[model samples]
Target chain A: MKKYVKKAFIDTLPIMAGYIVLGIGFGVVLKSAGYGLGWALAMSVFIFAGSMQYAMVGLLTGGASFLTIAITTFLVNARHLFYGMSMIEKYKDAGARKPYLIFALSDETYSLVCNSDEGRDYYLLVSMFDQIYWIIGSVIGSLLGAIIPFNTEGIDFSLTALFIVVYTDQWLNTKNHVSAIIGIVASVVCLVLCGSDKFLIPAMISIMVLLFVMKKFCIKEEE
Target chain B: MNWYAVIAIAISALVTVSLRAVPFVAFRGNKQLPAFVDYLGKTLPYAIMGMLVIFCLKSTSFALTRGWAPQLIAGALVVVTYVWKKSTILSIVAGTACYMVLIQIVFR
Candidate 1:
């Protein structure tokens, strides 16, 4: 248990850096939206997907229907379908803790836990610890958001910064750039051809298909 | 906060937590995952990163053609830095610094 705790804490170090900045941004946006610290805290604690939570503020304020919010959340997070799919076998028998692990599979948590060389329970523990970082950051940010008197102009761009970091990290770690290249090209092409409202899903689908085909044919030949 | 808003937020959290917890419960005693799931485990991170980049690039106030060109260049530069160095801190700082400089010099 002590070892698990140590691993969890160590795993969270980088993410703690990310959460503080990103959570502060979320807090600023929520405050600017007139929702106060309570809303920011609530969203950070519950709707913990960083980017999606940022988008949720607009959905809530726009008076989007529950169904609209649900669908949007689903579409925005549909990549989780693959995230969850990847975990199905590893998580086949975790007993009571299985569900929470799935819930906590945010981008950072997933990256940490999925890449874990430790035991399964330790991965879950690391994920829990990482979630705690986000929760703490959100709570602190909301409190600061409530008290801070200045406009939090340009704060929400932290999400953009985060995506850039994640993308860069993945590119750095992977052996080849095939997947990343496919994703960028597919996204740009889809964005150009389909436009914003229709872009994400098709981009995702096309990239997934493109990667799948490439892995099957091109990568296999090289290997 | 309105009671409905509170309720909605609570429900959202509940749903989200349940999803997070699923793996802990289901994988209690497992050691190794199956073949296909393992393959997914490899690719899913790239997919998530891809989705995030697209989302960020699209939603920023910059018009895709002009305003975001520098950002795109900076984003690509960051990826190159990461691949070459494998340092997260370095990559993030470089990307942000590049974008900041571009915004100041070119976009301004």
Candidate 2:
């Protein structure tokens, strides 16, 4: 248990590094939108989805409809269905810590657990620690945004940078490049065909099918 | 939208958490999953990662997308750097630097 906690802490460092910058950006943006530190902290605690949190700024400022927000969130986070499906077994044994694991399934947390050394109870540790870092960064960012008045023109790019880093890491660690290449190709094709508004769903569907097909065909051939 | 966002965030968290915790609560003392679900579970990450990689590229800035030429160069550079040697920071820096040089300097 002690080692589990330590490993979780260590594994969470990269996520914390990413979250501080991303969360700070979120804080500044939320503050600029007229939400106070309390709101920022609350959002960080409750919402915890980085990209969606950023999008929340637009929603808050614009007064969008509840239905609209719900639909958008469902779409934006649709991939979680797949993620949750994968973790069914991993979470099956979590016992008392199970609920918190589900609550804390942000992209960073998921990535950490997914890529972690298998069979270790590091998942629970990483989840808790990652949530802590995110919450801290957001609260700090909101407070600082209120106090400091720097130009925030390009802070949004930090989110993109974070994603780039994570994707690069996955690409590097993956021994088989087939899935990576398929993702790149399918997504680009979908973006061109569907446009930005509706690209993600179709692209994801295509890649999912392609990967399944590859698995079936290649595994059979190997055998 | 503010009120709605607040509510959505609250509800989404609950729903997601519940979904994640269901298996744990259901199988607290168990280590095994049903065969088909187990198989799907194993393959789920690659699918998720595939979706995420696409998601990231969509959000990359227009500054990197002036023409097919620069995007192609930068994309190839990223793939090569990534495949030859796996370094997250290096790939990002190389990709970004390639974009900057191609779009801001050379193409300009």
Candidate 3:
């Protein structure tokens, strides 16, 4: 147990850096949006999706309907469906930790756990630590928002940098560029047509449909 | 908390959790996933990562010379640093530090 916990902690160090900064950014955004510490705590603990939580600040400020927020949340996080699918076999025997495993499966957690050969306890510990780092960073950010005097204008770019780094690594490792190209083209088109605010769902749906169709065509050609 | 905030948070939590648990629940039992579904499971990670990169840049406009420059430069630095060093932490931290410096100092 100690070994698993230690391994989990060591593995999560990178995510700790990313989540803390990103969480602080979210907390600062929430503070500037007139939300107090309570809201940051609640969102960090509950919604927990990093990017969606950031977007939720906009929805909360804009007075978006509950339905709109829910739908958008689903769209933003639809990729988790893929993550979960990939992990089904791994988590099949996770037993009591299964629910929390699913609950805390954020993007960073997914990336860590998807390739992990560790035990269930290790995955659980990693997930728990990641959330703790996020919560701590958010609380600190909320507290610091009123105290800090420095400009935090572009700090949010950390999240973008994190994604870019991950994408670069994935690109370098992958043999197939077809799916990557499809995702980029579909998303760019949707972004141009539906606008940034409404492009996510369209891009996701198009990618899914296109991949399915392409798979079918390839299978038929092979037959 | 306000009622609207509570409701939105609850809905977001519900939706996010449901999405995460869908595969486990839907694929309950020993039933195997279809070939295409398996292919997607393997392929989607790379594609989704790509999509997320674009999503992160969605707010920046290329038309505004100043708006996109910092992001593009910082992003390139991130990719190059990662490719060169193969250290995720250093690459992300360096790129983010570069962006923070550019926007707070250089671009200002």
Among all candidates shown, the one with the greatest lDDT: 3
lDDT of each model, Cα atoms only? Answer: 0.66, 0.66, 0.82
Task: Please write out the lDDT profile of model 1 over residues B1-108, one tens digit for every residue.
Answer: 477667666656655555455444454455665554465556656665766677667754464444667677777776687777876656666766676666666666
By TM-score, the best candidate is: 3
User: Model 3 chain A: which ten-residue window has the lowest total lDDT?
Assistant: A214-223
Question: Model 2: residues >4 Å from true position, as ranges?
Answer: A4-10, A118-120, A146-178, A212-215, A218-223, B1-8, B15-36, B60-108
Where's the lowest-lDDT run of ten residues in candidate 3 chain B?
A: B34-43
- Residue-level lDDT tens digits of model 1 in A1-223: 6778875775566667667667777776777777877787778767778767887788777877777766666666665565676667565656677656777778667665555457678867877877777777776766676565644433333345556667666655566667667777888788878887678789878876876677764243221
Cα lDDT tens digits for candidate 2, A1-223: 6778876775565566568767887887888888878888888787778877887788768887667766666666666666676777666667777667777888767766776564435777787788888888788788887454643333333334445555566655555556556767788889878886688778878877876677754223221
Q: What's model 3's lDDT at B11?
A: 93
Candidate 3 Cα outliers beyond 4 Å, as residue runs: A4-7, A29-35, A55-65, A216-223, B1-5
Candidate 3's residue-wise lDDT over A129-179, tens digit each? 999999988998888885656666676676677677777776686655677
Kindly state the number of residue pairs that clash in model 2.
Answer: 1
Instruction: State which candidate, 1 or 3, has the greater TM-score.
Output: 3
RMSD of each: 4.4, 4.5, 3.4
Tens-place lDDT per residue, model 2, B1-108, is 456657766765555455445544554455566654565565556556655656755644455445445555766676677667665455555765676566666766
**What are the runs in model 1 whose C-alpha is more than 4 Å off?**
A1-14, A92-97, A146-178, A211-215, A218-223, B14-39, B60-66, B97-107
lDDT of 3: 0.82
